[model samples]
Target: MATKGRRALRLLGAPHITVACLLWFGVLTVWGTLYQADPLHGLHGAVQRFFHSWFFLAGGVVPLPGVQGTSALFLANLFASMLTRFERPSRAIGLWIVHVGLVVLFLGGLLSRQYGRETTLVLADGEKASMSVSETGWEIAVLTPGAEGRREVRAYDVRNLRAGGSLAVPGVPGSVGVVRVIYAAVVSPAAGLTPSPEQVTDAPAASDPRMDRPAVVLRAGDERLVLLGEGPAAVLHLEGGGEAHLLLRRARLPLPVSVKLIDFEKKFHPNSGIARSFSSRVEVDSGGRAREVTISMNRPYRHGAFTFFQSSYMDNPRGPEVSIFAVSENHARLLPYAATLIMFAGMAVHYLPRRRRT
Candidate 1:
């Protein structure tokens, strides 16, 4: 067992491990670069799908180790080298400093990946919002009437559902079982069907053809109902008494403060219809205190751990103008700067000592 352990240590500390990881890293970079030309992933999609994953498909066909896997192995190789290869005092201190810098950079990246969040906040003129919704994730919201005629809301992430998934909530009659999910569908009323005031129009006219709305069929005991994303929520009458309303919506995150859009201004070049810039003036309400801030093309508003950048605006000359802010919350935002400084210090120390000797 002791011999096996020594062998394992030597294998981990081998120089070839580092070489192999670097080779794979280069391959992944090139693969992702080539894959981004296709529309499936887009600019950010390649990094999200391939670079950060453990294993991902190339061209949706070939399998390859992702950047995360290669990085982890490279870190392990460096750690093993520190333990077994750098034990002697004669080793160059400059090289050790460089390694330490690299370790710090890697650790910072890991922390950012684990804790960082990116979302968007959209507000029409004079509108206020306290929560921002996610761009991708979907949720099933159950709205029921509570005591004193107040409404209560409970949300469940749709990612947790499957063909036989069951949901049991308090005050709900029987178990709610998912029959099936239509990932993309256009709900149309049957022929000779009468349209109700709550019924939504079938499939949007200008929506992307590739895009699909989610629809679900759920069963509770003997009753079954179909819920469509384009229409009003399916209202279920409970056997015990009250009513339950189920609607599909984007997952939301609460903000530390609420923001109200005061005004949106757009500038145009002289004698041209082209836009020069756009800005939004917003009032932030935290607790009972209120403050006003302006966000523009290059300017961002920073509060606590959140930063809001003016990203876009809707074109509405006659109606209320809407502003979109790209919200980013990253605890390790300064990690890259610190890592760069450490690397510069390492290089300077290495070169200055050698120059003095010369």
Candidate 2:
């Protein structure tokens, strides 16, 4: 009688669990495809709701000898026991490796999500920064007092600034000129201006400033026009745009270490015009340890806790200079590597032995 009752419960519970899994899988598939277009769309919401509903259902339906999901644990242990009992050696080995690898992968993902740091540092043609800001995209400017005075190092959050927009510098009156960001598709020359299909009634009226032959006329307030070249500073003549006390300065973040670009080298193969290598000779000063290092395409330099790689290069007729470093730190990056190794080993053993047997 007890055996029959247990069997009946299993029959009823199996379909519910299967249906719940299928629903979750469908939700995941739809969410993955549409997430980019409309992140807050209904499909994403529905997936979260479905998971919560089914997880609750699963909790109630599955009987536990002690706690709730403990039943899953017991079921897994029972399957293992059955495999061993039936002398299914190959299946048991495969299952053990696969399960262990999955567990390791999950733990690794948790660690990385909870603790990962990524940052970018931009040094001018010959400037140095004292701190690094990665996620917030802000750089700290450390101002050591000059021989005559002591000014506290000011912290500046510099991002891509608009051409006409104003930025407030603390203790200094008026706004500074931040870089103007122009989207290639949205900007066109005044001589060749065309209305965009997606342009709304409230869109700004401006011409695209091309890099080939660049010119910008930025309006401040309701009046005044400032003509800007590609240079660091531009003058604005304003009727009522205040006294123009602040000069327009480009936005840049400060780094902890100072880097001076000593020299840049670009080389190509002798016979073929194909480029062979590009590198930068940079002088870096961190923690009073000053050293010069050459960072090339795959080669990176390590200093203390930071690794600097040659990530990009800029070429002009005068000379070609390369940018160095893309920095990242994840405390739990080894788990994926271990999982990959385990998977590779399992595939090797399974296939090599099968081939030998054949």
Name the candidate that leads on lDDT. 1
Structural similarity to truth (TM-score) of each candidate: 0.79, 0.40
Deviation from native of the Cα of residue 112 in model 1, angstroms: 3.7
lDDT of 1 by residue, 117-212 (tens): 777899999999988876655677888888899988888777687879876655676678887665554544651222222332334322222244
Encode model 2's per-residue lDDT on 65-124: one tens digit a residue.
221222333334334433333366565565456545655665565455446555555444
Global lDDT scores for all candidate models = 0.76, 0.47
Model 1 segments more than 4 A misplaced: 1-7, 13-27, 59-61, 88-97, 181-212, 239-241, 341-358
Model 1, clash count? 0
Lowest lDDT sum, 10 consecutive residues, model 1, at 191-200
Assess the local accuracy of residue 21 in candidate 2 as a C-alpha lDDT between 0 and 100: 41
Q: What is the C-alpha RMSD of each candidate to the true structure, in Å?
A: 5.0, 13.7
